[model samples]
Target: MKNSRSKPFVIGISGGSGSGKSTIINEIVERLGPEKIAVLHHDAYYRHRPELSFEERTIINFDHPDSLETKLLMKHLVQLISGEKVEVPIYDFPQHLRNSKTKKISPCQILIVDGILVLNDSQLCELMD
Candidate 1:
């Protein structure tokens, strides 16, 4: 049941907070089968700012694209497309910082990237199929 394609098909989903993007993604994953797809959340890529206190981090505008480490995400996307595994960052929502642990994701036939500002980045948009 593995994907036979040489490269995974990348899909980017973007929307504002409280939107139905997550719901839509869930439906798609359910219909397509989760085993055949890999999902990357932009929220998980939030920059790890250890120097900033929890209060300071909370004050930072997370809605801005600058708050995310898009470069790292881009690099990981490239690697996933190349059939390589990646250790994705785990963000602590309450603390507004990245946890020391990471989630290891394997390349799949379909790659779904979702975030509020995912499509806002020109370079990141270029990577989508």
Candidate 2:
């Protein structure tokens, strides 16, 4: 038996680089059906540094929590929980910048937020149930 409420059950998946976080997410989605879950990757919220050259951006330490726009991610999560549509930002890894387009995410029954720093943010932690 599972909870069938309107509000989603947010699952925070955190781990080190190359630690199989996406593998775990894939398994969850496979079992739960992708339609029932909305996946939000913290890496997608990486701070945009268009002013920097490709070489400079490539040299930046992406491991630091400061490298991500976590505040915006938190806001999107809050909005989703409130049953509102949110335009999730897309990061262009190769370009090292946020893409001009956003993924429009609708409210869902399960919101799975995955990233190395997902659980590190106090506000984000409070919002997950």
Candidate 3:
């Protein structure tokens, strides 16, 4: 479904590592107030590879777009746009796996998706406003 005018204005921020995506998002959040916007980090959606050891996971190139679970992120975005609550996955960067805990994200007036490869996914890009 398409996002309606009453729904949140979704913004996808895509850039390389240390490219100041967070800086930009943070600035917007500061001006808009934390309660006015919802932030989703793409790194938090990394695929859970529990079968691999920490060493093996460390060797994996997270820089690759495929390293993230883009599909799940897209699903969550859909739910958010539909005015539904979503349980966003929490990732353990040091362990290279998704943690059991999840963050409950509610619908907001503005949604900011911050990540390195957000624009690379056609479906996700199409869904963004």
- Whose lDDT is greatest here? 1
Q: What is the lDDT of candidate 2?
A: 0.91
Please state the error at residue 6 of candidate 3 in Å: 1.5
lDDT by residue (tens digit), candidate 2, 27-68: 988998888889889999999998999999998899898999
| Local distance difference test, each candidate | 0.93, 0.91, 0.90
Candidate order, lDDT descending: 1, 2, 3
Instruction: Encode model 3's per-residue lDDT on 69-124: one tens digit a residue.
Output: 89999899999999999999999887788899999999998999989899988899
TM-score of every candidate? 0.95, 0.94, 0.94
Q: What 10-residue stretch in candidate 2 is worst by lDDT?
A: 1-10
User: Which candidate would rank higher by TM-score, 1 or 2?
Assistant: 1
Residue runs of model 3 more than 4 Å from their true location after superposition: 1-4
C-alpha RMSD of each candidate structure in angstroms: 1.5, 1.2, 3.1
What's the TM for model 2?
0.94
Best by TM-score: 1
Clashing pairs in 3: none
What is candidate 1's CA lDDT for residue 86? Answer: 99
